[model samples]
Target: MTIITRFAPSPNGSLHLGHALSAIVAHDRAKADGGRFLLRIEDIDGGRSRPELAAEFRADLAWLGLEWEEVRAQSTRIAHYDAAAEELKAQGLLYPCDCTRAQILAADPVIGPEGPIYPGTCREKHIDPHNCDGPVAWRLDVAQANRKTGPLIWEDELAGPQTARPEMLGDVVLLRKDPDTPASYHLAATLDDAADGINMVTRGMDLFSATHVHRLLQALLGLPVPRWHHHSLLLDEQGRKLAKRRHSPSLADRRLAGEDGRALAAALRAGQLPTGISCSK
Candidate 1:
C-alpha cells in the first residue's frame, strides 16, 4: 500500500526548527516512498488560531524546498468532528464535563503523561448524552469505552508494536466547551487522519502517549488505524525543548536573516543541529 504522511502544525505561532524537522521528515518519507504528503493547519482553537499565520507556514515550507500534494485546515472540518463526537456519545462513551483546569488541579490530581489527569468530578453528574446543557467539555470515558472494545493494539514505526492502555491518560476531553467547535486535538486528529487516508502519522515524540488515547478513539469511533513515527524534538542552547512561547527562532526569521532554508533542511535530515539548536535529550 502507498504511504501517506502529513505535516500538521498549529498556526498559533511561527514555525521553529522543531516544526521544520517534523515537516521535512514527513515530506521526505512520503517522497522517498513515492507516496503523498499533505499539509494540515490544526487551527481548532478558535480564540488562538491566526488565519494569517497559515500563509507564513506555507511560505516557510516552500522556502525549505518541501512540497505537499494537498493542503487542509481543521477549521473547515467541524462537521466531521461533531459527527464523531455524537457517535461516541451515542455509544455512552462520552459525557459532559463541567470541571475546569483549576478545579482539576485543586482536586489533587495525579500527574499523567499529559499533565494533571482529570479526577472525573463530573462523571456522576447528570450529563445529557444527546444534548449537554451549559458550558462544559465532553470527556471520553476510557474505562467504559475499553470495556466495549476489549484489548486494543497499535504500532509505532520506531517504538514497535504495543498494547494500548488508554486509561493511563484518564478520561480525556474529546470535545471542548466551544459551542460552534467542540472537538479537541485528540478527537479531531483521530478523525482527520482517517478522513484524509493518512497511512503514516509523523509527529513529535512528546505526543507519543497521546497515541494511547487516540488508539482508543479510533477503536470506539470505528476509524482506520495508521502507524505512527514520533520523532525527536528540537532543543535550544540550554537544552530546553523549543517552544513558541519561549521565543525560539522561527524558520521565517532565520530565512529573513539570510539563512538558507534548503541547507537548514538538509542539516536537520542528517541529524545535525543548526547554529544554536540542539536535540532534546
Candidate 2:
C-alpha cells in the first residue's frame, strides 16, 4: 500500500520552530518514502480557529519548502465529522459525559493509557451529550471500546516502541460536549485520516499517547491503523519547547524581520536535525 502522511497543526497560534520541524519531518517523510503528504488545518475549535491564522500556517509551511498532495481545512468539513460522531454514538461505542471538568477532577481518576485519562464519570447518567442546538463536550465509551480494542502496542520509527493500556486510556472526550464544533481532536483526527486515505502518521513525540488514543478510536470506528513515527521535539535555547505563545520570537516575527523561510528552516534544522534531512543549517 502507498504511504500517506499529514502535518496537521492547530491555527490557534503562529507556527514556530517546533512546527517547522514537524512540517519538514512529515513532508519529507512522505516524499522520501515515495508517498503523499497532506496539509491539514486542525482548527476544530471555531471559537479559536481563524482564517487569517490558517493562512499564516499554510504560508509558513510553504515558505519552509514543505509540500503536500493536497491541502485541507478541518473547519470546512464539520458536516462529515458530525455524521461520523453520530455513527459512533449509534454503535454504542460512545457515551455522553455530563460531568464538568471540576467534577472529573473531584473524582481524580487514574492516568490511563492516554495522558490525563478521564474515566466515564457520567457513564451512568445516560444524558444525551448532543443537544443539536448548543455545544457541550462529548466523550467516547472507553470501557466498552476496550472490549473491542486489544493491547495497543506499536513501534515508532523515531521514538522506538510504546504501548497504551485500555485501562490506562480512559474514556476520551469525543466532542467538546456541546462544543462550538462537532468533533474533538481525537474524533476529527481519526475521521479525517481515514477519509483522506492516510496510511502513515508522522508527528512529534509529544503526541505519542494521542496516537494511542487514535488507535483506540480507529478500532472503535473501524478505521485503518497507520504506522506512526514520533520524532523528537525542537527545543529553544532555553531548553524549553518552542511554542506559538512565546511571543518573544514568533516565526512570523522572525520572518518579518528578514528571516526568510529558508533561514527559518535552517535555524530549526540547526537546533534538532531529523535523520536523512539534508538541510543547510
Candidate 3:
C-alpha cells in the first residue's frame, strides 16, 4: 500500500508551534517514503472560515519548510458530508437529535477532553422530544453501535500500540441537522481521510479521544482505517499545553518580531513527541 499522510488544520488562526511540528512530521514522513503529502484546510466553521486566513495558513506552512502535493479545503465539501450522512442514516447508524446544548448540558458532565462526556440521554427514545420541534443535530447511535465497548486497537507512530473505549469518548455528533448547516469536524474529517486516501493521520495527543470516532466511521463506511499517531503536546512554562487561548505568543507573532526560519526551526526541534518517538524537526 502506498503511504499517504495529511496535515489538516482549521484556519481559525495562524499556524502555531504545535501545528508546525505536526505538518513537518506529515510532510517529512511522506517525502521519506516516496509517498504524497496532502493539505486539508479544515475550515468547516462557516462563521470562522475566511479566505485570508486560509491563504495565511499556506504561507506559514511554506515558511516552515513544509509543503503538500495537494490541498483540499473542507468548506467546499458540504455536499459530500450530506451524502455521507445519508449513507449512515440508511444503515440505521444515525439518528436525529433534538436535544439542544442546554438540555444535554443539564444532565451532568459529558467526561471529554474539552467538556463532560455525554450521558446519551436520548439513547432509548432515539428522538429528543424536548426540542423535537426543529433545528436538530445528527448523532450516531453508540448505544446500538456495533459493539458494547470499543477497545479500538491501532498502531501509533508516536504513542504506539494503543487501545481506546467509548465511555471515554461518548456518542459524537456527525451532522448539525439544521439542514442549513454542514457536518461537524469528526464527520467531515473521516470522510475526507477516506476520500483523499489519507492512510496516515498525525496530530496532537489532545485529540486522542477523536480517533475512536474516526475509526468507527471508517468501519461503518468500509473505508481503510488509517494509522493514527497522537504526539505529545508542546507545553508552556506553566506546563499547560500550548494553545491559541492560553499560549498567546504564537509563532506567527514571534516571526513578525524578526525571528528567522533557522531560529524558529531550532525551537521546533526541541518540541517533544509522544514518549519513545523522535523525529528530525
* Winning model by TM-score: 1
Backbone N/Cα/C clashes per model: 0, 14, 5
**Best candidate, lDDT:** 1
Which lDDT tens digits does candidate 1 get at residues 22-107? 99989998899999999988988777878899999999999999998655689889888888888988998888887778889999
**Local lDDT at 25 for model 3:** 73
lDDT of 2 by residue, 222-274 (tens): 78877888887766556566666765245676666765787667766566343
lDDT assessment of candidate 1: 0.88
lDDT of 2 at 154: 61
- Residue 272's lDDT within candidate 1 is 83
TM-scores, all candidates, are 0.95, 0.85, 0.86
Instruction: Give candidate 2's TM-score.
Output: 0.85
lDDT of each: 0.88, 0.72, 0.72
Predicted structure 3, TM vs. truth:
0.86
lDDT of 3 by residue, 3-73 (tens): 79998877667777777777877777787888899988887776666668777777777677676865668
Q: Which stretches of candidate 2 lie over 4 Å from their true place?
A: 111-115, 128-136, 159-166, 237-239, 270-281
